[model samples]
Target: MKSTVEQLSPTRVRLSVEVPFDELEPDFDRAYKQLAQQINIPGFRRGKAPAKLIEARVGRDAVLSQVVNDALPGKYSEAVTEGGVKALGQPEIDVTKLEYGETFEFTAEVDVRPEIALPAYGDVAVTVDALTVTDEDVEEQLKGLRERFGTLKGVERAVENGDFVTIDLSATVNGEDVEDAKTTGLSHEVGNGQLIDGLDEALVGVKSGETKEFTTTLLAGADAGQEAVVSVTVGSVKERELPEVDDEFAQLASEFDTVDELKADLRERVEQSKKMNQASEIRDNVLEKLLELTEIPVPEKVVQAQADEQIHEVVHQLNHDDDLLAKALEAQGTTREEFESQARESAEKQVRVQLLLDAIADAEDVSVDQGELQEHILFQAQRYGMNPGEFIQQVQQANQLPSLFQEVRRGKGLANVVLEAEVTDSDGNAVDTKAIFEPEGDEADDAEADAAAESDADAESK
Candidate 1:
């Protein structure tokens, strides 16, 4: 077998391959064996007929066709490997020549990984938002904790903001009842704005058994974007009574014995949360900077394929109802054209990011060990709310293990870039990015546990 490559473009290639007849003996043998099992030769048992006999029965053209079909994939893969072509997606193969004893020739056109000139990692810098946790932030956290422990008491008065209410809601568009928009005895919180547009305002000040009517545009269903007259009948109103912020209340709510101690812990937790948010901002800003500095040309075919897949998924979620898609887009103030345009743009960006990170991973010789891969799989399973074993089996069945492996490698690549780049807060203070992106091995875990135990001992001693 001999192969050569033609550069179709930076992101694509055409491979010309020629395999001599002598090199295809294995393929011919397999093809003949397969045909022998299916063909009935007078003196031979099933799968025991001679190749020449089978060919005589089925014709040489039939045998050659089977051989060509069976040989193409392996031959194409060999050509790609020999040519060192990093093929991206499926290849389009065209058989150019197939002689009786001379040679079999074909050409494959495929999308290849483009050559990317990586930017200097040391020169990359990004400024993220400063980590700031104020008293109000701690108070907000405390308020959430209090809300979780609050008691709901039935109120005899009108519904007010922050009150929970049980109500029956029915909507009609132009006097025709909207079946999808009607529900009975739904519990909602006033001022939460989780349900319909004007539901919160309509619920406020409505006493039990009082019905309020409001006009709002339906966001989904058949009448989406059309104004609907909604009738809401309040069944009951209840207010949450929070316990006082005292020592006793602290003991009741947490292991802490005093409100001051609870506030201190809340403040520390809020600070940690703010730091995490800062780390997230740094990751985004760093990626944005890298994209700005680099010029990565994405393949149009790959982008189109991804965009089509995304559009298909969106339609699938909508139950393939074109009208529902249109109406939903209308309610969101977007048209089908705009939605497609946005999807294409998103797909292009995603492809660019994947290609760029993959190149980085290759350049840095980034590798994902079994442990890291397993950890990533577990994380993904938790995210998708699937059992680990089930998710693994499903991904394996779909042949998506390589894609997941690539994802892990790309993450490690990006983390390497982040570690090399300079990151600072908005206040011009250098951020401790290593702490955020660095792997916490067993040593780090042991250190953390020891520190925690020491802190607990100190608290007890005090």
Candidate 2:
């Protein structure tokens, strides 16, 4: 067998392969056996017929067709390996020749990964927000903590913003009652704006036992996407009573015994949170800088496929109804054309990032150990609300391990870039990014636990 590759473009290639008849013996044998089991020949048991007789019964062309179909994948893979083609997606193959005893030939056109010229990571620099925690920040954190411990007390006044109210709701779409939208005794905050449009406005200044009517579009149910007149009957109104920020309150809300100690801890927590945000900004800006500096040609097919997938997910959520999807876009103040354009842009950016990071991983010779892979698996399982065992099984069944492995490799590659790049706060102070990106004591312990859980998950799956 011989294969030669022709570069069609920077991101695509065509491979032509030729194989002599002698190399097809194994494929012919398997095809004959499979065909024998499907056909009935007199005086012969099932799958016991000779190749000559099977060929005579089904025609030689039929046998050769089956052999070619069975052998194409292996032959294509071998040609790809021999030609050193970094194929991205499935190939379009065309059989050119299939002689009786001479040769079989075919050509495959596929998208290929483009060669990348990587820039020096040390030369890349980005600026992020400074990690600053002020008195106002600490007080905001303390206020949130106090709210968590706040008590609700019955109030004898009109419902106000931030007040909790128990209300019964009924709705009608086009003068017809929407049964699915009717509910009794639902608790909602006056200004939360979580339930429906115009609800918060109508609830404000309403007293207990008062009923207010408002118009809102029903987002779900049989009458979804239709404007409905909703009636909200306020059953009771209550105000949240927050305790004073004193030493006694500190003991009740946290392990700290004094208000001063609690405020100090809150300040530290706020600073830590800001550090995380700064780290994320650094990572994103570094990637953006690299993308701007480099020229990476992405496969148009892969980008289109990803865009189609994004659109499919949105359509799927709308129950595959095109009208519902259009309505949803309208509700969001966007057109289908605009949404598609955004999807394509997002998809192209994602593909470019993945390809660029993959190139970086290759250049750095980054490798993912079993523990790291297992840790990622555990994290993804928790994200999807699945046990590790079930998640692993689903991943294996779908042949998605390679994709997950690539994701981890890209992450590590980006981390390497972030480590080498110069990152500074907006105040021009050099930031110690390693403290945010690198695993610390707690993270290391979490990795160990993830490994143990992976062992358990493997056992459960088996």
Candidate 3:
């Protein structure tokens, strides 16, 4: 057996392989055995027919066809490994020659990873927004805390922003009721705008027991994308009375016993939050700069696959209904052509990023240790609200553990770039990335825990 490679382009290759008849004995033997079990012979029991007898009954060409079909995958893989081709997707295989006592020859064309020229990590530079926590920020945080401890009281006035209201809603399209669009006693915040369009404006001046009618385009359901008349009746209106910012209120709201202590803590939290935002900005800007500086050729097949996956996800979310998908696009004010164009653009960018990061990881000899992979798995599980064991099982079942490992390696490679690059705040001060972007250790763990706790606190405040 022998194989050779031809470089068709920077991101594609063709591998030509030839296997002599002597080298195909194992493939022929397996094919014969498989055929023997499926055929009947006058004097031989099932699975006991001789290879020559089976070949005589089925013809030599049939036997060779079965052998070629069974052996192409392994032979292609061998050719790929021997040629050192980093194929991106499945190969297009073509059998060039096949004779009983001669040689079997085939050619495989596939997309290969392109060679990338990486820039000096230390020479990269980026600037992020300056981290500045102000009195207004602290005051906003305090306001949120007070609102959380506030009590709702029955009010006699019209609906206002920040007031909670119980309402009954119904909609009709073309004078026909939409059963799915009707609900009773639904609680909503007047100014949130989380529900149907024009709802907030309609509720602004409506008093209890008053009915307001407005027109809105139904986003989903059978009447999706249809203009409907929606009627909302205010069942009750209640205003939230915030607790005063006093020592007693502080004691009731937090572990702190005094308002002064609470405010000080809030200020500290605002600063920490600003720093996290700064770190995120730096990471994004650094990657952008790296992408701008590097030239990477993306494989077309990989980009297509990514785009197809994106489309599949969207379709799956729409329950594989094209009508629902069209309605969703209409709701978002985008057309199918625009959506496909954006999806392709996103897929190209994603492929470029992955290729660049993978090259960097290889050049830097970045590796993912068990501990780092476990930490990543744990973080993902928590993010998706899955138990760690269950998430691991799912990942294993899907054969995505290798992809996960690559993700972690790419992350580490980017972190290394962040550590080596020259990063500065908008004010020209050197940003302290060590506290936020540093590699995992005890200090990093502590910082992560603190950030998680602060994030939970922020969510609770909301």
Per-residue accuracy of model 2 over 1-462 as CA lDDT, tens digit each: 999999999999999999999999999989998999999999999999999999999999988998999899999999999999999878999999997787999999999989999999999989888888899999899889989999999999998999999999999988999998889999998887788889999999899999999998777766667889999999989999999999999999999999999999998898878865676577677888898989999999988998999999988988898888777776677889999999998888877887888899899898887777877888879978998999999999999988777767776777778888999888999988776666678575444334323322322122
lDDT tens per residue, model 3, 1-462: 899999998899999999988888999989988988999999999999999899999999999998889889999999999999999988999999998988999999999999999999888999989888888999999999988988999999999988999999999999999999999999999898899999999999999999999999998887788889999999999999998899999999889999999999999999988877876576667777888999998889888988888889988988999888898789778988898888888888887877877898898898767776777778778877999999999999999889777777776677778778899888999986775766467647433433332332222122
Model 1 steric clash total:
0
Q: What is the TM-score of each candidate against the true structure?
A: 0.92, 0.92, 0.93
| Candidate No. with top TM-score | 3
lDDT of 3 at 264: 94
Cα misplacement distance, residue 243 of candidate 2 (Å) = 1.6
Which 10-residue window in model 3 sums to the lowest lDDT? Answer: 453-462
Q: Write the per-residue lDDT of candidate 1 for residues 1-462, one digit (tens) a residue.
A: 889999988999999999999988988899988888897888889999988888899989888888899889999999999999999878999999987676999999999889999999878999988888889998898899899999999999999999999999999988999999889999998999999999999888899999999999898777877889999999989999998889998998889999999999999998887865675566566667777899998888898998898899999988999998998898899999999998898888888887887898899998767776777677678767999999999999999889777777766676677788899888999987778656388644333222222222222122
Candidate 3 matches the true fold with a TM-score of: 0.93
> Each model's C-alpha lDDT?
0.83, 0.85, 0.85
Worst 10 residues of 1 by lDDT: 452-461
